[model samples]
Target: MRGHDLINTCLPDELIVEIFHHIESKSTRDACSLVCRRWRRLERLSRSFIRIGATDSPDLFVHLISSRFSNVTTVHIDERISVPLPLSELVKKPDKGASSSSALKLHYMKENNGSTSAEGDFDSLCLSDAGLSALANGYPKLQKLKLIWCSNVTSKGLTSLARKCVSLKALDLQGCYVGDPGMAAVGQCCKNLEDLNLRFCEGVSDKGLVELAVGVGKSLKSLGIAACAKVSNITMEAVGSHCGSLQTLSLDSEFIHNEGVNAVAKGCPNLKALKLQCINLTDDALEAVGVSCLSLELLALYSFQRFTDKGLCAIGNGCKKLKNLTLSDCFFLSDKGLEAIATGCKELTHLEVNGCHNIGTFGLVSVGKFCKHLSELALLYCQKIGDGGLLRVGKGCKFLQALHLVDCSSIGDEAMCAIARGCRNLKKLHIRRCYEIGNKGIIAVGEHCRSLTDLSIRFCDRVGDEALIAIGEGCSLQYLNVSGCHKVGDAGLIAIARGCPQLCYLDVSVLQNLGDMAMTELGEHCPLIREIVISHCRQITDVGLAHLVKSCTMLESCHMVYCSGITSAGVATVVSSCLNIKKVLVEKWKVTPRTKRRAGSVISYLCVDL
Candidate 1:
C-alpha cells in the first residue's frame, strides 16, 4: 500500500488531532497543515497559543489569526517589528510640495506637550484600538493575553477586550500605556481574572489599583505592580481590604511604607508569597507580618536597609512555616537577625543572601545547627563567610542539594571538603571568584558527591586539570563550566570526555591550552554533547572543531569567538555536518557576507562579532 493510503487507513481524525496536539514545533505543524485540508483544520484547531507582532498590517493580521485559530486561548501581542527596515530605505528625502505623516504627527505631538494621543502615529507603527477591537470580536474565548510594550493600546482598546473576553484569567500589560481606566474596565468586566501583572505601566496609580482591587476582590490571587511610581500606600490598603484571597503579591515602588505593608499583613492572612523591593518599610511592617501572616511561606526583600534584627526576629518567631527566603543588599542585617530566623524557621529549605556583607560565620553556623531541612543555599558577595560557616552547614544540612558561592573570598578547600563529605545528595555546585578554592576542594567534591550533575568553577585561577580529572572519574556531570580557569588544559578535558559520556553542555572559554586532542576525545565519547563554548581557546584549530562536529551530531550551538585557528572551511564543515546546529557565534574576520548567507541557509541564528 502507498504511504498516504496506509496513513489514512490507520490514523483517524481523533488520532491525528491527538498527534497534532503533541507536536510542539510550529514549523513542523505548518508543514503538516500544507499536506491536506484536513490536517490544516486539525493543526489550526489544536493551536492554543499564537504570538503576533506589530509590524504586520494590524487589522488584517488580527482578523486572519483570530479566524484561523478560533480555539487559541493565549495570545502575546508584541510591539517589536517583525523585520526592521534598513536606514537607507527609511531615510527617503521629503518631497518639495508634500508633508509626511510622521512630520505632521511630530508637530501635533509637540503641540500637545509630547503626548502620544495622536491616532495617526499609531496607525502604521503600532496595533491601535481598531485592531484590538477586531481581535476581541474574533477571539471571545481568549483566556490569557500579554500585551508587551504595546504603547498604542489605550483604555478604549482594553475596555473592548474586557467586554468581549469575559473568561480571561491572566493578563500581563508590561510596558503598555494603559492606565486606571483600562484596569477599571478589566476589573468590572473580567470577573474570573486571577492573575494580573502591570509591571512597567507608568500610568497606573493608586486610584486605578483601588478600583481594580474592588472589582476583582477575592478572586485576584496574584498581582505584580513594579516600577509603577504612582502607586502608594492607598493602593496597598485597598488591596489588603478587598483582595483577601491574594496568594502572591510583588511590589517594587519607593512609595510603599510600614503603614501600607502593615495593612496588607493584617488583611491578607492567606498571603503565601510576598516580594518587596526598593520600599521604605521598617520593622513595624515585619512585626505585623509575623503576627498576622502565619501562613506565609516565601519572602524576598531587596535593597532594604532600615529594617534591623528586630524585624527578622519577629518574622522568625511568627512565620514558622517560611520555606524560602531571599535577602539582597540588606546591608543593615547582621548575624543576629539570621540566627533568629534560623532558630525559628526550621522549615526553611532555600536561602539566598546577596551583598549581605555583615552576615558572617556565626549566622550561617546558626542556620546549619537549626535549619536541618535546608536544601539550597546561595551566598553572593558575602565576603565575611569563611570555611567555618560552610563546614557547619555541610555537617548538619544532609539534605542539601545545591550550593552557590560567588565572591566569597574566605571560602576555601576546607569548606568544599566538608561539604563534599557531608552533602552526599549534592547535585549542583557553582563557585565563582572564590580564589581560595582550588583543586583540593573540587577533587573532594567529585570524590564524595557522586550525584553532582552541574558544576561551574569560573575565574578560580587555582583550579586546574586535576579538579576536572577527578570530576570526570567520579561524577557523571551533564553541565560543566570552567571558563577563565587558566590552569585547565586538554588533559583534563580529555579525561572528562572519557568519563562523562552524558555531558551535554560545556564552556571552556579562555582555556588557552585546550586543543585538537580534547576535541577528538569529546567527539569520540560524548555523543550527547549539544552545546559548547570554546571562545578564546587560541590553540583550537579547524581540525579540533571538525572532530567535535563529526561525532556530536546533536550539537545545536557552537560559540568559537576569537579562536584564530578556525577558518571558514572549519565553519562550513560544522554547518554541513551537524544538521541540528541552530546557532554559530564566530569572529567576524573568518566569515564574509557570502559565507554568512550560506551558513544562514542551514543555521537558525548566525552571529559574527569582532
Candidate 2:
C-alpha cells in the first residue's frame, strides 16, 4: 500500500510547509513535533526563536514564553536559570513613590554596577518589571532582545521594552538594570534600532547616552559602551553629533581621554571597527585615529600605557586603509613603531602585538620588510622576539596564515625552520611558553605545516613523542592543545590519534603520563570528538573515561580538573553514556547528585577542589 500511502496522506499545506523547512534542528523540530497532528501544526509555524532560561517559575517562565511563542522573533534572557526560582515571590518594585526622574538619577545604580548583588543568590533569577511587561505583551513579532544578568531589570523594565517592542532591531542590555529612563525609552521607541549593546549598563549615564544619540542615533549601526561608568566626553560629543551610520565602536572607560577620542574621530565618518580599553587614551587619542578614521579597518589598543612611539607613528602615518591591528599594553612601542608600520600600513592584514617590550629584532624585521598582505600574526610577551625576528617573519610573510608565539623566549630551532620554510600557507599555530622550543622545533612544524588546523604547544617542556609523531604523521588536526606538556605521554596521544583524524578540540591538561591509552586512542581516532580538557591528569582513570563515553559521539564539554583517578562509578559512566553531555568539570564528585537527578534536563556539574 506504498507504506500506507506514505502514512495517511493529506499533505499539501504548502507541501507540509515545504517538509517542515527541511527540519533544521531545534532538537529536530522537537522530534518532528512529536510526529503527528500535522507535524504539530508545522512545528508551530517554524518557530522564530525563543530562549527562556532558569525557569522553575520566573513567573511561569514568562507565562510560558508569552502563551507559547506567538510568532516570536528572538528572546534570550539567560544568565543562570536552571530551575532554582525562590526569591520570596519576586518581581515587585516600581512604586517607591512612583520613582522616575530617571529613577532618581539612577539611585546609586546598584552601588556602581561592578556587579555583586543578586540579592545574595537565594538562587538568583529575578526578571522583574512585571517580567518584562509579560515579555513585551507576549512577543508581538519581537525583533531580537538579550537581557543577561537581568538582576531585576529596572528602568521600569526598559521602559516597557521601549514601549512594547515596536519591531525592535537588536538590543542587548548586558549585565542589566537599565538606566537613563531605559535609554530614553530605547531612543524614543526602537526607531528600527540597529544593534546596540550596553555592556555593564550601570544605570547608563551621559543623560542616557545623549538620549540614545537623540534617539536611534540615526539608525545606529553597532555601539557597545563597555563598562558604562557614567559615559564621559559628553557621550562622545553626542556620538559624534548623531551616529552618522556608525560601524562598530567599543570604548572602555576611565573618563575616556584625548577629548573623548577627538569626539569619536571628528564624528564617526563611517567608522569601521574600533575597541579601546582602559581609556584615558593618549598619543593624542592615537593622533585622532590617524586624523579621523578614514574608513578605518579594525583597530584595537588595550591598556595604552600612555602609548608612545608618537602614538604608533601616527597610526602608521595615517591609517592607509588599515586592516586589523591590535596592540595590547603598548609599552612605549619600539623599533620606531615598526618603522612607522613598514612605512605606513600597506593594506595590512591582521597583526597583534601584546605587551610590546620596546619592540625587538628590528621590530620583526620591520614586519618582514613591509606587511605584504600579511595574514594573521600574534606575538605575545614580546621579550625582544629573537631567532632573527622569527627568521624575518618566515622570510617576510609569504601570505602567512595565523601564527601566535606566546612568551616568545627567543624562539628556537632556527625560528622553527624559518616557519616551516616560509609559512607554507600555515593554518593556526600557537606555541606558548616557548621554552627554547624542542623536538627540533616540533619536527619542523610537523614537516611543513600541511595546512595544519590549530595546534597549541603549551609549556613546551621539550615537546614529546617525537614531536607528536611529527604532528601525527603530518597535520589534519583540529585544535589540539598539549597543555603543560611535561613530556606528553601515551605516545604523544597515540600520535595525535593517528595523524589528527580530524580531532575536534582536545586539551591534555597537566599531562602526567596521560593514561587509558590516550583515552582509548582518542575514542578510536576522534569520532568527531567535541571538547575535552583532561585537567591535572593523574593518569586519567575510570577505564579511560569509560572508553571516552563509548566513543565521543559529539561529546560536549568535559573538563576533569584534578582527575584523582575517576570514581563515583566513573562519574556515573559519564552521566550514563554521553547523550550529548553539556559541561562536567569534576574532581570531588559524589556522582554530582546522581548526574543531577538522572540528566535533569541534560547534565551540568562543576565540582572542584582537589
Candidate 3:
C-alpha cells in the first residue's frame, strides 16, 4: 500500500468491487489493473471472459475488445489466439522449372491472390470477415462462443455471427471451417442455443443436422457431434425428433448403429452424460442405454466392437443413476459384464477398464463387493487381474482414492500388499507394466499409503533402493515416476531428495545407476524441483549438470535424453544456472557448437541424437 495509496480514496466502490471478486488471479487482476484509474475501471468491470485472437489487430482487436470487455460473456477465438503469422504469410507454390513465362506468371499470381479457391478462404484467417464483424457488432450480448483452430472462419464468418449474436448460448466449433452454411446459420440465428459443439466439422451432414434439429432442437442442452463422416441414421432420426431437451450427448461416429443408439435412447429421456466413440454398437445399443437412459450418469464406451456383456448387463440392470463408467477397447466385455455392473450399480464411482480382456478376478470381486461409493480406479490391460482380484478390490473399495495399474501381468506382492492394506484413503498410485510388482510390493505402498501423492513405478524392473527408501519414509511426494527402474541408483536418488521436499514432478528415466551424485542429490534435497526427466541415464555427467544448476531454483524443465555424460559444458551450466529454465533436452554429444549458441540464449536446447 505504499505507492501513494489512495486505495480508491479509501475503499468503497462497492468495497472495491467486492475486493475485486476475491482476486481470482487473471495475473492478479492484471496487477490490480496497474494500480490506478480506479483500478483500471474496476478491472475492466470484472472481465467477463475474453480470449480474442486469430492473430489480433482486426481494427485493434475489436477496438481492444470493445473498449475493455463491454460485458463480454465468453469468447475464445484460436489459431494459437495470437503471435503466429510468419510462414511468409502462408500462401506458397510456384518453385518449378524457371520460366514458361515464369510459369504462366505464377498462374496469374494464383488467380489474383484468391490462393486456389473459395474467395481465397480467409487466406489463413486470424479471425476475418472483419473479425466476425467486430465480434458480432461488439459482443451483442454474446453468450459463449469458441472457434478453436480458427482455420479462417467461414460460412461467411458464420453468417456475420448468426446475424449479430441473437443471444447465443454456447457454441464451440473446433477446428472450424464452418459448413452446412455454418450449421444453417447457427440454427437460424442462435434460437437460444444450449451448448452445441461441432468437432472436426466436415461440412455437417444429414442436411446440417436436420437444420440443427429444426432450429435449436427445443433449446438444446449439450450436444457434441464428433468427426462427422456424413452423420447418418438420418442424423439420429433428426436427433431423435428434435432433441427433446437433450442432456449431454457426445457421438464420435463410426456411423452409429443399433438404429442410431436406439434413436438416442428413445429420444433423450433426460439423458445424463453419454460418450460413444467409433460406434457400430450392438447389445442393442447397450440395451437402448439401459431401458432408455434411466437418468444415466456419465458413461463412456470407446471403440465398440459390437458391444457385449449383454450391453453391460443392460447398463447394470437399467442405469440406476449409474455413476461414471468407462470401458475402453471393449473386447466383447467379460467378467460376465463386470459382474452385472457390480451387482447392478451400487452407485459406482469413476471406473475405467482399458483394453478389457474379459474382466477377471471375478469381475473385480464384484467391483469390490458393490462399489461402496468407489473412488477412481483404472485397470489397464486387465491381464486376468491378479492377487485374488486385487484382494477383493482392496477390501471392497473403502472409498478408494485413485489407483491405476497398467499391463497388470498378474500383479504381485499380493496385489501390492492388498492395495497397501485396503486403500487407506490412497492418493494416486500408478504402477505401469507391472513386472509382477517388486521391492516388496513398493514396501507395501510405502507402509500403507500414508496419504500418498502420486507415485508411478513404470516398467518396474524390481523397483529398488528399498523402493526409494520406503517411498522417502512414507510419502510426501508430489509425483515421482521411477521410469524403467533399473535398480534405482544414488540410493534411490538420495532417498527421493531427502524424502520429497515437496517435490514437483521427477521421472528417473531409464535409471541405470543415474549419476553425477544423483544430480547432486537432486539439487541438494530437492529445492522444489520443477520437472526433471532423466532420460536414458548413462550415468549423467557434467558433474551432474553442475549439481543441477547449483541447487535447483525451481528448475522448470530438464530432460536428459541418452545422457552420454552430458557436455557442451553441461549444457552451459544449465543455460547459465536455471533462471527458471524452461526446457533443456540434451544429447547429440550434449550439443556444443559453442554450447549450441549459448544454449540458444537461455533455455529451450533440444539437440537429441539418441
Best by lDDT: 1
Give the least accurate 10-residue stretch of model 2, judged by summed lDDT.
105-114
Model 2: per-residue Cα lDDT over 322-411, one tens digit each:
888888877778888877876688778888899888888887788877887788889999988788877887898888898898998887
Candidate 3, pairs of clashing residues: none
Candidate 1 C-alpha lDDT tens digits along 1-610? 4555677667888889899999888899999999888889988888899897755345445655676788899998887746444222433445677567545433433443233556554454667677688789888998999988887789999999999999999999999888789889998989899999999999888888899899998699999989998999999999899989989989898888888989889889999998989558888988999999999999998999888889999999999999999999998899999999999999999999999989999999999999999999999999999999999999999999999999999999999999999999999999999999999999999899999999999999999999999999999999999999999999999999999999999999999988999999999999999999998999999999999998999999998877888888888888878988878887666665666776764343334344
Q: Can you give the lDDT of residue 91 in candidate 2?
A: 28
* Candidate 3 local lDDT, 1-610, one digit each (tens): 6756676567877778778778878888888888777778877877778875554233334444665667778887766644445332432454666545445434533443344455544453455565676678878888998888666667887878887897999989887767787788888888999998888887778887789788989998888888888877888878888888899988898876778779878998998999988657688877988998899999998877876798889999999888899999888888989898888988989999998887788888888888888888999988888889878888888778888999889879887788789888889888887898899988888888888888888887878999889989888888899888898899877887888888888898888787888778778888888888887888888887787778777787888766777767777787778788867876566566776675563444356444
What is the alpha-carbon lDDT for the whole of candidate 3? Answer: 0.80
- Report every candidate's CA lDDT: 0.88, 0.80, 0.80
Ten residues in a row with the worst lDDT in model 1? 106-115
Q: Global CA lDDT of candidate 2, please?
A: 0.80
Q: After superposition, how far is residue 314 of candidate 2 from its true place, in Å?
A: 2.3
